[model samples]
Target: MHVLSRTLIDLYDAAEDVAPNEYPAVVMAVMHRLISFDGALLGCGLDAMEHARIFHRSPLLPSDYAKVYRSDPLACRLRLGLRVPVTCECRRFYVARECAEVKRFYQRHRIARVLLFGDPPAGRLPRRWVALYRGVDAGFTRNERARMEEVWPHVSRGLTANRRRHLERHVARRAGAASALMNRSGMLEAQDTDFRALLAADRLDVADGVMPERVRQCWRAGSTYVGEHLQISLQECGEFIVCTAVPLGCAVKLTPAERIVANLFASGLNHRQISERLGVSQNTARSHIAHAYAKLDVHDKAALANTLALDPSRVKTGRTE
Candidate 1:
């Protein structure tokens, strides 16, 4: 028991350091220490059975395993709903002809027994499961099942911690910006206080943890949305999207043309070059630059560059002209 406790602690600590993709392998490794198994699979998805998605598998299963597993009686039972840990002796649980394909798959892989455990959906967390497989015909003992039950919660918690740490790293990338993690369906999976506050400031309904339709559209289109009070930048991180919202402030005051002129001028283009590049007269280019200068409160080109530098989203550098 002492060793198990220590192992779980180490597992939790390790969750903070490993990348999201590597977390499942770490969990499986920790589980192997507590209970012996030949192969393992870790997955997460919504409460709905059709939504279940596999994230990782150790000692990779055959390519057809993905297609055949859904037909397995045990897997079908799990999909119906897995409220607790359960062990299945394949020969007893599988139907003779109904699950022939899945049975054949198991036979080919030398799998004869299985143990499954699940962490049901909670709040923004998805339904997660771990499956252990054995090649020998011997069924998993009750003691092994009990050990898995004891270890299941920590494994689930470790997954949660891994995702939180990943989102926190994205938040840290931009100082003073509100950060959030959203699923593919555009529901807010997790967010910090700053994120909630920012949403409230925008007058969007965040009570249901749903992103605004406009923001969702922008996310789907792989674009950024500049709102009345904030600018949202979406970055795809694994299965989730990292949303960073920063106050628009004065950056929003400039018109679209003014912003272009400002960026070109800041990129070291003279008024003539800016006009030629933009297909506008030199006077029109100067007029746009003058308007940008006044709106941004910058009197000179150097001051304009410095001001735009503070908000990189406002500047597009790397122009040779």
Candidate 2:
């Protein structure tokens, strides 16, 4: 495989080992590797809300989309479409209608820079948006633009996959938590629709608990602080697990080899069949099945089947502080 491809895989694998909140940093690293921009930023959840919420923190912005888009000169230049794609939604009505509509809208908000791009894959946007600062050269070199464009599809694909995976995990976690909480009585209320809508975006974390002084201090010191929405509290304590919903035919948390084995298993393949698909010995395939069961916390295929039957939202396993 290509070096960047291998490196990207390694980064993803490593991401699995860290705290859930750390995932953004890992994602940013991947973005840096994929794009050659001078700077980049990411934000989730209320790309509009002003409060410091768990998912809304300006992973790169100063504050809400309006603030960041209005303050950066490069962003303004991009809005003017000096080098960026006019077809991109980021340009707003400026490029959309060629009318003063977008410009007027910006003026209404008193948002000056007007450089912004938001195509939240987890939200209403159909595709991830792109924004760029056409350097002083006025336009990107043909090769540079081409290279950037070449990777855009791959990056978009990766982001889409990641967002879907993230949302699946979020659903699984909420379902599991809600079921558990419900079974234990009314210790926790059913999340309201407003909260649910926010949570559904996969960017918001709304569990209540006490916060450590250090964490609070960190948020305060940052130029952008959206972590308050995370609702981290000091009273809660326990292991938390990140969970994902895997489709009926999909294998969750499996290596490529294991995925092949899982597909074989789900296909009603015996050890011999699985071995053939994996190009391994039947014994090896059997061993892999055993390992898969262990990872899945099941004993036999019957139990594995049962576990798989349960929706991820109904299951809870991973725990993190």
Candidate 3:
């Protein structure tokens, strides 16, 4: 809850030093500081079978990875599954009993360590490995180390949730572009080369303009229309939303009356105006929002909006169970 420590702040800044490739190193270094690890190893899978990029661990060669890649129990689990989280202390018996290749590699490197294995969000990994290793001698005290283990579940859940948000954003963007193309694809069929280019340009301009209006509509809805999902532009649009549409996931669903209220809210209607428009009392309008929060599974309007905008794929189906 407190602001990050000065040391962490410095580490955060330093993380920016290496554009993107340095992420693992920065993460390893930061974690090393936080947890007091002897040495850390980061091996991230890139595009599945294209070969994993190994960093941090020294004298732990590619051959070691190659051997592990084919036979390591953790690696096997990761490759076979979608996403999983595990923290386990692995000894020589693990290598010897599980896989011969792992055993041989372990014998060579004297590899006996506890490992935290995580699969990054779908689409985030293979580009990132499912396994992370920290040498045992890392100076973490018993209590401090236990704290790390205890917090890991929550931290992993948060990270996974964040990754899902990112994935939703990406998929929605692609869907928007595809939808725009489909609208124009009909026209492009009859156009000549030059005409087709002009049509294409016009469509791009129109879609670009339309996206902002959509964002504004979502933002203005306020309490009535909890913005569980929206697509906003990220670029400089004096009139447009942002350059891109964002999908915010909501925690709850809205009822039909609530949906109407939300639409009115987005239209910038005041409570009195909404009541008059919907032919309901002012209290009724207020009640709609209150009920909307319950149905939408949100604590507040802002959170509702954020959730909606971040997770566009969420369609209010049955219960969220």
Candidate 4:
């Protein structure tokens, strides 16, 4: 194996040793070793609701997060493209200079060489953007981009898998937590007692020691899936095929305005349509929706509807912004 390839393998193999909060540094370390960068910034969960966490190892970063992160040029570029695939999705490689926003940010930070990598499609989880910078005049080379492309698949799986396992536990605490182990065929090779109870509550039964047909279908769809009344997130934990099954709890704690937004949202309305229906501004509608999601402990419109027993398929394909 090439030295860089071996390093990636080692980094992923040791991912569990790092805590979720501190893992960004490890990822940055790997990127630094491979591409030789001066500093790094990693953002996860970039959504219009602004449920994001950004970690930076940059020089002279502002002490106040609001001063540094608010109106962040990069986050704006990213969340602004949440529904627009062509611009939101990076082609496994990026040079900051290629983007005017990135160019301006780099110049302001005195950063020259730059590279950003997006999550692999298979993860289908959060939108993660990793930025690495160099202070001198040299820019990232094609060779380095090629190297990053080679290693990104493993990195995406490892990083997201670890992060999911960590965050899913929090979700579980807020709702009913159940877990199951499945084989390559999506058969339930093992399951906790709570897993059976959680599924049974919604009339989903384990047939002949295998996962339900609905679950098998969802598994085929992606690593994450939300059934009509339950949302399950999956990840590969070592040799274990693990899943966190969170029961859909409509224990939504929203204000009256947010309740209005939630009702409009449940009817499959996007931000703009919801605003028009409620006679509110788009920003106001978005704010209410964000608050509703936070109160319900859901992430996106689809998940929100699923939890609230709403039919999201009826939603028009309108951008949230």
Q: Which candidate gets the maximum lDDT versus the true structure?
A: 1
Question: Mind giving the per-residue lDDT tens digits that candidate 3 earns over 1-321?
Answer: 332354355444554343333444555554554454444444334222323334444554455657465666666665554343444455544644657666665546544454444444454212233244545523324554454444333333333333333333333444433221111111110111232222233233332212223333444552221234332333321211122322323333566667667545544567898787777899988888777666556786676555445655444322111
TM-score for all models, in order of appearance: 0.60, 0.32, 0.37, 0.43
Candidate 2: segments with Cα more than 4 A from true spot: 1-4, 45-61, 64-139, 142-321
Return the candidate ranking by TM-score, descending: 1, 4, 3, 2
Q: Which order, best to worst by lDDT?
A: 1, 4, 3, 2
Question: Where is the poorest 10-residue window by lDDT in model 4?
Answer: 84-93
List candidate 4 segments past 4 Å from native. 48-104, 120-123, 164-176, 179-321
Cα-based lDDT for every prediction: 0.74, 0.40, 0.43, 0.58
Q: Could you say which candidate leads in TM-score?
A: 1
* Better by lDDT, candidate 4 or 2: 4
- How far in Å is the alpha carbon of 309 misplaced in model 1? 25
Residue 108 displacement (Å), model 2: 19
Measure candidate 3: CA RMSD.
Answer: 19.1
> lDDT per residue, candidate 4, 1-321, as tens digits?
888877877677657666555666677667667776666655444331222233344434323222444454445555454222111212222243255443444456665555666653333444455656566766667777776666665666666655555544433343357776654445453455577778776677774455666766766676566655577777665433566787654442455577667767876778888777667899998888888787676898778777666433222333234
- Which ten-residue region of model 1 has the weakest summed lDDT? 46-55
Off by over 4 Å in 3: 1-12, 15-17, 46-56, 80-85, 95-98, 120-127, 130-321
